[model samples]
Target chain A: MPAALHALKDFSDIHINLVGNQALIEAELASKSFDKNRLSITHAEQVVDMDELPSKALRNKRQSSMRLAVNLVKDDVAQACVSAGNTGALMAISKFVLKTIPGIDRPAICTSMPTMKGHVHVLDLGANVGSEGESLAQFAVMGSVLAKAIDGNPKPRIGLLNIGEEEIKGHQRIKDANSLLKLIDINYIGYVEGDDIYKGNVDVVSCDGFDGNIALKASEGVAKMIGFYLKAAFNRNLFTKFIGLLSYPVLKAFKEKVDPRRYNGASFLGLRKIVIKSHGGADAFSFFHAIAEARLEVQKNVPALIAQEVATLLTPQVIEATHNEI
Target chain B: MPAALHALKDFSDIHINLVGNQALIEAELASKSFDKNRLSITHAEQVVDMDELPSKALRNKRQSSMRLAVNLVKDDVAQACVSAGNTGALMAISKFVLKTIPGIDRPAICTSMPTMKGHVHVLDLGANVGSEGESLAQFAVMGSVLAKAIDGNPKPRIGLLNIGEEEIKGHQRIKDANSLLKLIDINYIGYVEGDDIYKGNVDVVSCDGFDGNIALKASEGVAKMIGFYLKAAFNRNLFTKFIGLLSYPVLKAFKEKVDPRRYNGASFLGLRKIVIKSHGGADAFSFFHAIAEARLEVQKNVPALIAQEVATLLTPQVIEATHNEI
Candidate 1:
């Protein structure tokens, strides 16, 4: 809130969508004591319950905070919408409001997951489960664009998540999708194993949301579990404690470096507008970082670039098919 | 060789089909200094190549090491077979040599992977990549039995791996398998997440080999990558070094506790004869451990128990009703 307020301090054409209790939102804004003329705060009448039944949260969208945020983007009150609420609901409203870009089938929530080597961006982790072949191909395209915009790579090497490195691997749907991606001239690196997710061998990792979510959760749970055991082991004996003393700097460096909070922003690619889905458990700092990402994405015109690329890639195929069909 | 020879010296009438190079087998037997009458070492003309094509490894009727191992069990030349070669080949040979246990459609491989919390015994890691409804149900039944016999669970809780936890969740195959498991009252635990494998939340985690292999590799890769970074970090600076010093003993204890050597045996579960498939990269110790497990399973008559239980479970349903017909 402070960062947004500060950014709008000298601007006359800025407003904020404070999606929560009316009085609380106003009071929080008042406490900030920024240029009142430059900023306007609109309290959202309803907020989606952030819970396991994330899909249900969007049902009461008439007064939902997420709906209001989408409305701001739709109404041109804001160039981009940002939310740290229920991701499912945010994706829901974004689809309903902003709509997918032309030549794009479905929008993908793309996030850069940090690896030991560096970073790898994976799409559709929580946005869409049980993806169709066409949609997966679309995710690959959007993920490549996102990586490029982030300066991770000019044409990020894209990998389809599979059990093996063989061409004839993966589920039937993924197999069909592999053929579709081959038609495009993208930098498509073939099948990648789960180990590749962290090995940093590929920049863009794409999979159905079900597997992606499972992979992300499994990775996170294992890390936490390892930390727990490591902590327990450190307290085992005096001799080991002495050894740990010698290794203290290394362990501390690792913990600080691998912290998830360092990369809190997740971009919803392939939308007509740029939207960043922040972590549900994000703090003020993370929320600010997400907002910052939304600003950069909007500035970079990532959606427009993706739209252009998708059209270029698909138009020829579509035209050839139309000719062949005729 | 030494341990078996020592046992042979103490307990008479142990027959050994010593396959591979005659000189090496003779030297090993001679070094053990066992009574010549107690240890009968018959040299086999051939050994199974680890890199042989699966067809050659699987279909070769010649006395290939793998085939010889299976033949020993089949012909009562040896009580069981233990091999630390190609797993796919072992599964194939086990099936071809021993035949499937009555009422079991396909063979499943059960391996115990050390999770962050405790141990998770996972099934069908590679044996059956594309399992059918009946095959999965059979796997569930067999896994439950193995858990009870080996892991010492009175009634092992079995979970079907799926995209969701609800009974109504998952693809058609899982739904059919779930219905079958429920009908038989096989201690079914509905569905489980990928992380559940490491969280030790489920006793037996069953999945198609594709996802199972991916999940296993993902866990292994993440732990290793983090360990690598942590080591690098420990050497970075001084203050972090203090934290590492504080945490050494507990981590070492944790590492020792989860080392794969403790649970190195993987059983090819649907065969009529006992076949323990050791890791291809296993050393002499792991191979010997696999042998011990195979011996135990043979002595306990696990295959017979599985066949009996599975037959009892399926008897209630019409034998004429096929999966496709359903």
Candidate 2:
């Protein structure tokens, strides 16, 4: 928190409103110097425990820190909200407070996946499991619009994530979604397998939350495993230790480029307002990255862009085409 | 092919039967030196294409090399079989030919997940997607039996792969499977997440084929991505390039330890006979690893062990308990 606050000093135009227990936040800020006008705090009555069920949290913690932060976005006091809270609870409150964008059926979690070329957007990473064809199509368009708005890449190559790339492969939902996508305006590549996520060829990868969540987390697990093995290998003997010392700079550069913190923000796309989710276990550096990401989305007006794209998506031509294809 | 053949020379007691197009197999083996008496070949009329649909290949290609290899095992000429072919076709034909072990409901694809401690077995990588609760429980028993037999752990720690560790966290399939696991005699440690697959604390991680396939492929993608970044970083400048040269040995050792080839074989468990599924794109070294893995499973009689454990798992008391819990 201190690191994030200190780094915010350079962003002269951005104002931050901290919502939490008033005294604790104030005490943490006491030792730091800042532009007092740019910093403010809102008192919240409680904090939602990470393990609490989303329904229970929604019913019991109306004045909780998470809810209060989201309310700022709702009241237009803030253009965007950022939370590193319980994902389900945060998602529930964000959807309840801000609602979905016009023509959007459900909000999807979209995050940047680091790849060889750069990064591509993937969704919905645990927001909606066992999703139907219609919902998945919505995610594809929402993700495509996000890429256009945020990455300035129009006609992003959108792919349906599947077990195989063949036309007849995968369960019915993907095949149904494939038919719907072909009728839409977005650049719909038929299907891509898991390895395509990092290939940098496809710009958007869409799948149900069950597969998406596992793909995201499993990728992280493998990265960490490789890092551990690399470290262990380098520490084996005096010669290897010397080699590690010599290669420290190269390794550090490599780590920075691939670090998850560089891609900290996960957008709750399809919502009326932008809500960026920082990893729950994120540090001050990662939180700062999340704020920076949220700032970018605000500048681009991502929600309005999605709402506009979806309006076009629902026009008679595309809708009739979708109907015919389905 | 040459490397695997060279490695097989030391294991002289084990004979090798190359099954494929006669001309192609002979041409490839002409330059390789092995004990001629120990090597033989079986000519097949057709080869199953990698992209062919499983049902199509099963129906159209009766004399395909895949069918002939499995036929050898059925004819008692071989104790086990290995294939680096289309997984769907392989599973379909293997099930058609060998059938499932008594007390086993279905065959699962089990592969070793490289972890910090060494490796742990993860099951149903892509065999039975959208599995029921009963099948999931059966996977647990079969996986535990294989772990005990192959890894020599009397009581292998088995966990249901899930998005969360909490009892109420995942879908009903996982919750139902959790209840069934508790009632069964396996060492069921409740739920584990994607990271737990690499944690090395648990010996067996069980999941439906959907999540399991994504997780496995996603992990591989991450490793490849990291390797790419590492190479790019080291080649950025002369100083880093020099460091890269110095660190080459250390890096090679690290890569060897974490290489997917070291953990290549995937077992099609629950079949009456041992059948290993090598990664379709695996090279000679990786195919050798698959053959080596098959040898271990054959020595352990993994299927019979699964049948015996499942015999206990299906006892009237356990079956009644399972019925009541779900």
The backbone clash count of each candidate, in order, is: 15, 0
Q: Calculate the i-RMS of every candidate, to one decimal place.
A: 3.8, 2.2
Tens digit of lDDT per residue, candidate 2, span B1-326? 66358547756557778888999989988887778887789999999999888888789989999999998988878888889998888888899999998877789999987899988999988888678787888888888988888888999999998875232366788788888888877788988888888878889999988788888888888889999999999999999998898888999999988888988889999999988999888887888889888888878888888888888886768767877866
Tens-digit lDDT string for candidate 2 (A1-326): 56457546957778889999999998988988888888889899999999988888888999999999999999999998888998889888998999998777789888997998999899988888778777888899899988988888968999998876233367778777888888888899978888889989999999987778888888888888899999999999999999988888899999988999889989999999989999989888888888988889889998998889888875667656766777
- Model 1 over residues B1-326: C-alpha lDDT tens digits? 65455445544544555555667777666655656665555556766676665667665636676777678789977777777776766777778878998888788888887665567678877666567767788888888888788768897888887754222145577667766766676788887777677777678877777667667667766777777777777545675555555555555577776566667789888888888887777766566667667766876788988988888887645333444345
- State how far residue A296 of model 1 sits from its true place (Å): 3.7
Off by over 4 Å in 1: A1-16, A27-40, A51-59, A126-132, A165-168, A237-249, A284-289, A315-326, B1-18, B23-53, B130-132, B164-169, B237-250, B284-289, B316-326
Superposed on all Cα atoms, model 2 deviates from the true structure by an RMSD in Å of 2.0
Native-to-model Cα distance after best TM-score fit, residue B157 in candidate 2, in Å: 1.2
Best prediction by DockQ = 2
